[model samples]
Target: MLTRILPPPGPARLLTVITMVMSLGQGLWMAINAVYAVTVVRLTPGELGISLGVAAAIVLLSSIPLGHLADRAGPRTVQMWSFLALGPLTAALLFVNGFWSYLIVSSVQAIAYRAGNNARKAMIAGLVPKADRVGVLAYVRAAQNVSVAIGACLAGLALAAGSVPGYRAAVLFTALTFLVTGALTAMEAPVPPVPASAGAAFAVLRDVPFLMFTALDGLLVTHALLLDVVLPLWVLQHTDAPRWMSAAILLVNTAFVVAFQVRAARGTGEPKAAAWASLQGAGCVSVACVVFALSDGASLVPACLLLVAGALVQALGEVRQAAGSWTIAFELAPDHAQGQYQGTYKMGGDIGKMFAPALFAWLVLGHGALGWIVLALAYTGLGAAMPVVVARGARMRSGVREVAAAGN
Candidate 1:
């Protein structure tokens, strides 16, 4: 039964395993780092925020250049080296005594992390068959979610202990994961190089239609912040639901992703199908928002029921959006420039996340039920517009090819 569900044995399986290991460490660190920084390292919340903002800025600037490096050298080599660097850089968090040290280390770690991530995307493009890429990627994402859940559980144990030693142990364990994954990545077979155009190093930077598509995609993706930042606060402040429902919602979302993500991705390998899936995903989330808004003034039982219903619907949207995003990102890029294109695609999500916390807070926490209504409308508009944007991008690509043919 397990064999029936898992990807066929080969590069796909190995890559999935690597993703699980890496994400496990990431989850552990992510769950505990903010508390550790504030309580143990003695930084104020504002300082921590500043440090993270700087890290985000650094990643945005460095991703494309690091991806280009992967294209020039080999993805396997770049990925392995970046992970090796990450092991030490992550461990350095153990020694941070002040905000400056934390800021410097975290910013540097973000750069290395982005480099490895870009190379990993490039490696998948080079190694996985086009038909299987989305399926294999879905499997990897599922494995990542499962491993991260396990890691988060372990972090919970340390948090329960509430001691310096316990926190230090989690950090050390996270650092060890990077080393283990890096060694495993070094053992994988190298990817073959794709033949690229000799035109320019950053040709992807100038594709206006693709750039527009990315912006709209980013706007649609702010739903991530809705799940993470908005929902918990809404439950605590507005609804009569028990506080535990916040964690319950996350558990439900994770379970849905593990069970349904691969299935959701099945027919999305084509661009039109992917765009349609995204539209449906947006619709589902819109419904969820309305449900949640209605829960704001309900009684306890009704609020709990509404929250559960909203979580399940949102999970459906999450899976569909994720699957569609993966397929569209892969299909839109030229084969030879997958690394650069993937990096550019990543920037969209990064940009969204950078702004989403503040935007959602002001929109939802600031305005109450009316804010949820605005969000639903915005998400619906973004989803409805994706197909048209995709069509425009396709036309632009066709025009570019026609001009090239005329010049020849």
Candidate 2:
């Protein structure tokens, strides 16, 4: 059942675990950051949204350049220092009490955040066998989920300490998590790529299939944002649902991610991966629609039924989606330029988020659940179109060598 915190503890395995631990710690604070902003920092939803937006902006702007640097100086160079600075930068947030203070730290964090995530993915792609990529990513998903679970448990304990703002405890614990983990990352040896240069980084994105994969992923991410923004809004406004419902939903997803993410990441063979992802994507869209639709439909009995059904189905899709995305991205990404691909690929999601929340919010405001149904349909449509993209990618892969051969 893959119970260890990370894969067997060789140097690579050890380094991966440390990175996951640090990421999980930071991710936990992120999981609860909104709570800190609203409850302790006293930012309105709009204010917090703006803070998130600013953080997202830094990533969007810096991704290519940072990726280029990673490509040029080697990923280890960028990753080591990014981690070093992150320790103190994130730790300082403990002293922050206001909106502006939080904003500054969050922005800095966005810059540092991409390093660990991209480098790890790039490193994994470099080490693991081609067919085993999904299996490894699945294991990775499970490990990171464990870290998140630990972080959440710690948050609960800190809150129990009472009287002090949760922000102080949360920030300190999270910062230590980053600092300690980042320090551990420094222990690993560099895994530099062939023909390491900025030109190689940009050259990779020029590939037709890779860009299509990136675009499709960006669309999927943009669609998925509905769960984060709209689902909770429906619960809070349209029903007597407790605030804990959001926590419940998150926990449900996390449990699934921890449990099944590996299996999901094992996404069927390339031939079937496309159709499977489409079906999974469609299910995700349908269930999300039905659940939110039920909450707004004004019947507790039906809402409960719909909510349970949706969450279960959605969980399945989450597994499929993660595996499918990783399989495709890793396969299509340029080998010598995997780090750049990872950064640019991740950067796509951050860019999508910039527009998604505001647009989805506007859509809901204009039409209510009617608006949601429209979006649900739109997402489903995109889900439907994914197979075509997948097929095209397959054909393109056939046309290209899928490798950077010996000098031009």
Candidate 3:
């Protein structure tokens, strides 16, 4: 099982281990970040939100240009530098005493992280074949999930020690891991050269059909919010089930993802197949939403059952969407321009992250039971629309090839 899941013992496997280590550090820092910020950094909730919002905005604006740089300079080179920069930038958070310092450090960290992420993703494309890309990505995702779970547990121990010092230790640990991961990544094989005709820097933006596909995929990515934000709020506010059920939902999600992500990715090597998987997954999510809504009026036993059922279904949708999205993104990208194209593809998720929290909060919490129904319908529509968009993109790609052949 280990041999099958991991890339053969070489750079690929090393990269996978590096990813796991990095995720562990991220998990540790994230688990303690809010508490640390409020207690140690002396940041208000509003200030924290504003600072993070600025960082997200910076990442959004810079991702494409960084991706273009990766395509031009090689993903390995870009990744190395980004990681090297990120270590110190993250460590600088230790000195953030006010809004200005926090904003500057966090913004630069966000840019560096986004650049590294773009290059890392492109490097995956470089390292793995098209047939194995989704599966390999699934393994990486599973590793991240497992590492994060462990890291979170470790962070919990640190928090138990005391808030201020413990949180600082966690952040410092994260900074050190970033440095280690960067150094390790620098030793990996170099990225293959890009073809000369990979088109202009932002050419991905001109592909209308691909953009539409990305937009729909972005909407689908909101399943993340469903698990992370919406369900927790909904369960606390609407359901008669115990509050611990919120934690249970996350546990179920992480467990299921770790167990079945690679299995779900199987047979989805093509964009059309992946799109179909996404649609099917969306159906599961829709059912979960309806089930979750029904829990509002039920007694303890039934409500618990409903929440569990809904969470399980939602987890299934999460795995499918992740696998499908990876396949579509990789398959659609031209080899020479994968870095830029993947950067653009990543923007879909960033857009979803930016808007889905507020949207889901308004829909699920503000509007009550009716909100869940609305969300379900919206997901269904997005799922149904994906195949059409993928087909359109296919036609467009084929047309471009035909035109190029004619010119030849």
Rank candidates, lDDT, best first. 1, 3, 2
lDDT, each prediction:
0.86, 0.69, 0.84
**Candidate 3 all-Cα RMSD:** 1.8
Backbone collision tally, model 3: 0
Native-vs-model 2 lDDT? 0.69
Point to the candidate with the largest lDDT: 1
Once fitted onto the true fold, the runs of candidate 2 whose alpha carbons sit more than 4 angstroms away are: 1-16, 31-49, 94-103, 157-166, 196-201, 240-243, 269-275, 364-369, 402-408
TM-score, one value per model: 0.95, 0.85, 0.95
Q: What are the per-residue Cα lDDT tens digits for candidate 3 across 225-298?
A: 88788888777788787888888988898889888888899888998999898898888889888888888767
Clashing pairs in 1: none
* Residue lDDT tens for model 2, 61-156: 777667666666666666777777777887776667788998998888878878766776666766677776666666777777777777777766
Candidate 3 C-alpha error for residue 241, in Å: 1.7
Counting clashing residue pairs in each candidate, in order, gives 0, 1, 0
| Residue 136, model 2, lDDT | 66
Segments of candidate 1 deviating more than 4 angstroms: 1-5, 193-197, 398-408
TM-score of candidate 3 on Cα atoms, chains taken together: 0.95
Candidate 2 structure, TM-score to reference: 0.85
Model 3: per-residue Cα lDDT at residue 272: 92
